[model samples]
Target: MNNKTRQFFVAALMAASLGTVIAAQAAGAVESLRGRDVETQSREPGKYATEKDGPPIERNYVQQPPLIPHKIDGYSITTNFNKCMDCHSWTRYRETGATKVSLTHFKDRDGKELSNISPRRYFCNQCHVPQTDAKPLVENTFKKAEGLR
Candidate 1:
């Protein structure tokens, strides 16, 4: 084989063993898994929130942690998320007792206060989400800051 090709192969082996790679080489797909990207290159990060019942009577104070009682699998979470604001928006929240969304939702594109859900705050899943099925993966000791306050 050519000396340059042989040199490159030897360099790649050394880099792999070292666990560090340049940006260009790292961006390249791994040779072992060229076509399949099941667990290697899946989209999105962060786990879904958990669903639970209301807090105890003694602890059942104001602004209770919202209960996510419904399943939320494969639900479209795009930039313009209509699936969420349909119910939780200020206009419809009162009709269902679903809690009025933030006042910021009342503003329009020009920042003028409108009487409806603003396009900016329409994506409810960005801050809130309903829980789905269980899949035991890793454990978490992290807690919410609100619980401390």
Candidate 2:
């Protein structure tokens, strides 16, 4: 109730909070995968060491965006210049043999079709990721659609 008593109570509360945090850390309650002991495990293996030189993989589910089959190093996807359009745009697909940008990419959020790739879908990397042979960080037991197999 008095100033001295109130100050003492606040100090005790602060000390108790600090003690709880220190105790949790000592007990390994905040362990992180990246913070594991180096002696117990080596650094995570680098990205898939080799790029596959085969056909694009089949999609496991409906509406799945196809994966990029080739390297996109140095490609730029800036608003002023989308390098992917050089090969994947509708006008260029026929000559370049690159897959055409999907019609869906031309649709606005309200479903009205536009003349070009939608602003929201302009970045190819947002949904379509390049396939890498990287080892899984965790086991994947996902099952494909029945007809896909």
Residue range 26-132, candidate 2, lDDT tens digits: 99786654344323333356324324445787899988999888767678999899999999998899998889998999999999999988999999999987765
Instruction: Point out where model 1 deviates above 4 Å.
Output: 1-49, 52-70, 108-116, 129-149
Q: Which candidate ranks first by TM-score, i.e. highest?
A: 2
Candidate 1 clashing pairs, residues 3+ apart or interchain: 105-118
Candidate 1 per-residue C-alpha lDDT over 1-149 given as tens digits, one digit per residue, 9 for 90 to 100 = 99999999999999887675565468774443223332233222423233343332222334444445554445675765576566666568888666566776678878899876666666666555454223445786645456544
What's model 1's overall lDDT? 0.55
TM-score of 1: 0.40
Question: In model 1, which range of ten residues has the least summed lDDT?
Answer: 33-42
TM-score each candidate. Answer: 0.40, 0.67
Lowest-lDDT window of 10 residues in candidate 2? Answer: 34-43
- Per-candidate clashes come to 1, 0
